[model samples]
Target: MTLQQRQLAADTPTRFARALAVTISLGCAALASMLLAEAAARDGFSGWDGIRAVLVFVTTAWLAWGASLALIGLFGGRTTALRPDLHAPQPRTVIAVPICNEDPLTTFARIAAIDRSVARADVTADFVVLSDTRDDGLAGKEQFAFARLLRETDGAGRIFYRRRRDNSGRKAGNIEEFIRTSGGAYELAVILDADSLMEGDTVRAMIARMQSDPQLGLLQTLPKIIGARSFFGRALQFASWFHGPIFTRGLARMQGPTGPFWGHNAIIRVQAFAESCALPELSGPPPLGGHILSHDYVEAALLARAGWKVEVDETLGGSFEEGPENVLSFARRERRWCQGNLQHSRLIFAPGLAGWSRFVFLQNVTAYVVSLLWAAFLVTSAISTLYAPPPEYFPGPYQLFPVFPDTSTREITLLALGVLGLLVVPKMLILLHAILLDRARDFGRSLRMALSVLTEIILTTLLAPLMLLYHSRAVVQVLSGQDGGWPANQRNEGQLSLCDGWAAGYWIVLVGAAIIAAVQWLAPDLTIWLLPVAVPMLFAPFLIAWTSLPLNRVLFAVPEDAAPLDVVTEYDSICDVWRLTWNDEHLMPKATSPDLTHATA
Candidate 1:
């Protein structure tokens, strides 16, 4: 055999072995946990309460999550297969792109591209550039530039720009202003973030769904990450593109009419949103205070409460958005999301919400809490090793009390295996589905890509604990009244510095290093167990930044053949026509209609 072919053949078994090892480990851990629980029950150890609680929580959560997915699959299967016939009529729709202190040139270029693309598809979509910048100095220039650019380019009559004199509730406030002023004229509104892009078909599909089901208030599409120039950005894009669909599909199926609203790249029935979805001020501190940071979840809940459906159509393709390419930028984005999700805790138990709405709210809450719990589990496991005796059970005799015998090392090893399996096996299931179901082709060559999948999974497993640590700390800080102010994202692509990494992950590094050093000094034999935790902790920052780099992008490439372009085309054409019409009417007065001659002169 050729050397390259031999190498490829050799690597296959190694990858399979690694995957098997993870599966075996997780199975052992689960068995150990079960045995430990039974032993604790027989021995009457009071400390088992916490262990029992954890087991119950994990088991129940898994079942509930599974049931939700099954329900969604049943319902989703009933809907007619999505096709061109599903496209909604060309309604007068307002496309609102909200911006705040973003690069004007980039924003304008994207809007112009979208305008051109939508126009080509013959879509009648209006453009609204809603600015929420409070910096008075920059606002005037932005407004003037926006107006002139629209006139000079293809944005004249069809595209409009508005600046909130007082940026009150931020993004939510910006949208409210538009609805109050001119929302009545449009049947539907498509909200897009500055970095968001969609194909013409996706938008049309969304409109079609809304038209078909008047009860549907919002239709959110799964957005694929794109335009990632940096290494970090590319890695994030790859992971997001590769893993997002299954999870989204699972989530949507589970959520039904109570799915999440991610703020952008979704269509909303204007009347439903206007009548039921209003952002309310939280009468408290920084994270949960005056302005709502994360309005998407709350809006979705409100829509559900008001008897309107909020659905996430994973089957609807062609939506895309850019992710933060730098560590600092990624953190900044996370901070805002953390605060928003945290704030939802206040409304979760509010009396008026529907059961489905409550379920959705609880799901958002769980997303954050699960991170903190995983971090706690790691820390507590280490501490338990130091303070507690190994597990033991004893039978009663003619004595006052009986002590349990210590658990075998075999049992401990099995328990560890089970825990690892829980972490990695589900992903393998997803990969298997992709390969067998023909979905793997989107990633790359089915055979070669299988290896990439294994590699990505290993890297991700090593990195998961570190992310849990970062997000857990963020959640704690926000809950404790820490103010993570609105920080601008680092849009530039550059090499990450040691200081930048440290700044982002100092807590993780310090804790991990200290634990490793202590274990090495006091109990060198335990290094094997500590390696799993210590390695990830010590290199938390670098690992995070590296994984997000462009090198990882290749693994995430959605075989160019499967790329979603219908939505992209629609978005582009809509923006294009708006710009063209605006430019012709406002800039080139010599080509104006005869009726407008007096006004032009």
Candidate 2:
């Protein structure tokens, strides 16, 4: 009695509710954009002022739109629960764990934990370690780790491993090869990243949803960050735990059946994926052309085009993934994603795509393109100040002497408040919602959660200028025909040396210094406004190094960090055993050292 054999009613959000949510979202964006344009044109509009105003309005409105959705979700009640037939036997699902040159020991331990979890729930599934490693040394290490994981779990036939010879299209190609070669044996394919870990119940629930809704081509789970070490990673973890749910719920409601696939922690109907998702090489060279770097979004669009429902179920919990420990690693990952997103401009008008799908593509591209707009705004502002003609109030035919340009401080202040409200109000709403729902305990209680949110706001505010510069440079490089080749993710990229940090962020510091000098020399009034962004750019290296350390964990301890999940605890215990098993002294041991196991326990 596989899950496909079960028949259950699928309940979706009412079309009116979905439409109203979108209307609120777009309405907020339109209001903010108008306010921003008025603010930009306050000091008498000029030719260059038009561009700055348009850019500010678009970027501000875009952000406000997201914040509006989150605010709406906070008041929209708990997520809609979709009942599934859990009593039916689980279907034959393949757990595809894709990897490259990641830490094999950690990867294998995560796999073992997931395997044990599914077995505990008595789900019928198989685990596959699909490696796209081009390096022979890393490939050997992966195999050794995989063998140890198999032995420890007593998994011989249930788990398998395969490394590709020519890592042609990277992860997308790897999965495609598997789908063509081995995906036929299973009805559902649960795609996972090297760092993904899902609880047995989470996996079963996702499968049941797909089975209940035969029209569902893909089901995505919201993966929370777990097992963070550094202050940066922990802060990100806390923020995601606290605020991610509200935004995700809003997004889910808006998406309806046409949702996003984040490349992992998602299950796809094998037959549908094979039929709709054979990505063709874009007709050009590299960077903005060539093979698609970001394939997940395109796949979702194709599936929707082929009449399959792709949804994100934010209500489902226990799906987890690890995040980068420092800013440098995060920037590196963002660079690749930035290039992939820009490539979508060519496919935006692909034939037969849904309107929402096209909007999604536009949104994805804007995620990175906004950086360029910010940089342009800053440059044009400075130029406008440096080369401005003195305000001449007396007209040619007027008899009066010189009259000063009138400044509307109250109107400007009101516009500033509007922007600030859009930025900060949603977080406050989410906080109130959490308190009302008695869910503050999950984030270290009300007081601690409030403190954490404040800290996150401060840290992100300080880091925004540094990120702006980094993203702007990435966009420029990609536009100039540069391809950021697929690089393996380093799971435990620990620290940022001062030199490395300076090398990565020196340009931002220089630009910040130059801007401060220009503003103070030409436009003294704007110097106060520039300090917030400039100071952070000047100290980016120190901030990066400081946040990469494990210091101040007690100050910002999230609920998960304060006390980890049971599966995390079990994974840690398993990792300790494997660590000793890989040690030279215990090289020949068939079983893990008793003392080591007892020590972890």
Candidate 3:
């Protein structure tokens, strides 16, 4: 074998060894946490309930997630059996790309690209640029301009545009209107996010799968991040590309026909959606009422509740979307998600919900609760530093009597390890999958990839305390009836700001600093336990911004196939052409109708 091949082989084992070492360490920590909980229980520690609850939640999540993987391995291995072949002669389908207040030109370009891509595969699908932009002046003009441009482009014949005069449920309303007015003509409807793209083959596969499985109401693909242009964005893209498949596979295994709908990059059986997926107006006040902020989960639940299947096809590759560009954008997106998940608490307790629906709701609630717990754990650690009892400098009479009190430091350390294991093991497992499946090539050299993973973990470890802080704060804000207004995120490429950092990252830093000071003053010998929390806190702002950078651009560079736009130049050219053609044979002047003459007479 050549030296390069030999070096590659040698490198593989080293990488695998590192992965194995981390995996073993995490597993040992998980086990130790369980044993500590059991020991604490036997000792009748009054505060063990909280520790036990955390351990139980952690262990249950781990096991439940594992069981999900096993189920997918057993049942989902044959998932292709469930998908239909769209290559056969099939009825015409309509692909709807929904847009609200967005960059209309970008939105139209994406729709055009998707249309062209699908057409290249010889897939005859109608394209609908569904706009829910209200009849407000600016948005209305943009929509009209978009419609005119689309008609002048290749989409003139096959593409259609519809703008709602009254925007009701936003996206859900927009989709419902299309169904009510024009859905009857299509066999299926594939929904695409304004920023999403699907390769022609993947789209064909989805349609084929739907055709084969008449029982399948929705087939959603895992979307890869493709256009991130910052450090954080690159990390997110790498992490998503590496870890997303495992979680998705696990989720799909457990979900069956009750999987989630992320509101985009999925195909739906039109009749089934119309019949079963109508979203109800959520009751109560702001944040939880009027319209569902998270209509996707609820819609999926409603579909499953109505006996229609909703499944995620993790194998459907080449589907892509953009991630939030920075920390502020991430928080804005997460805040809305938090409110939506919290609102699920009501539905969780509501009677008559299916078992899987309840499970789905519980999953969403647990996500928010877990964020709060991480924050709580940080607080508890800090308090323990300040309030915990010192070691016995002298042996007590009880020592002579043969009974010994347990060490609080050991217990706290074990608890900390347990939390770390829960967070880190999943990533290690994903990395293992990457190596074993020969997918590490996409991440650069094995050494660099390993370094990247280590860097990501270290960076993420530091940011965890901060994320907990922001998410907990957001959760509290929502619960207290505060509104997180809809603001367009800052997409400018830039460094972290002190104000933005404090808004999203202050909690971890403050908490970590407090812990360190308390440890120095109260428990000098136990300061070692603060390392995990301290590193992240010290570099909270940089780490927060760096990890949240638009990473997609680095991982998946823009393809040569992408279309570029010069907005000002294009508009001028379009205006000149329209003016010259105003009196042409195929054109009719505005306000020159028979009704005008009748009114004048």
What's the best-to-worst order under TM-score?
2, 1, 3
lDDT string for model 1 (1-601, tens) is: 3332232221333234324433543444455556545533442444533554365345334433443343333223223444444444566787899887664444665676666656655677888998876666556555655765686556778899988888787788889888989999999999998777766656667777777777778989888777666655655666666666666765664455566788898999999899988787889767767677778888887877677778887777667887776666666667777877787787889766756567566666666776776555445544434544444444445555667554445544665565565556556666776787787767776765676667766776676667666678789988889977555564443456666677777788997898788777754545677788788888887875665544643554554324546545444555465446544332322222221110000
lDDT of 1 at 285: 69
Candidate 2 Cα misplacement greater than 4 A, ranges:
1-43, 87-89, 386-389, 393-402, 584-601
Cα deviation of 441, candidate 2, in Å? 1.0
Best by lDDT: 2
RMSD in angstroms between candidate 2 and the native structure over all alpha carbons: 5.5
Q: What is the C-alpha RMSD of each candidate to the true structure, in Å?
A: 12.2, 5.5, 11.4
TM-score of 2: 0.91
> What is the per-residue lDDT of model 2 for residues 19-63, given as tens digits with 9 covering 90 to 100?
665576566656655654565455666777666667666666667
Model 1: worst 10 consecutive residues (lDDT sum):
592-601
Candidate 3: tens digits of C-alpha lDDT, residues 496-578: 66666666666667766877887777757557766666767766766666555444333332221133223222333544565
Q: Rate the local accuracy (lDDT) of all candidates.
A: 0.65, 0.77, 0.64
Q: What does the lDDT read for residue 580 in candidate 3?
A: 62
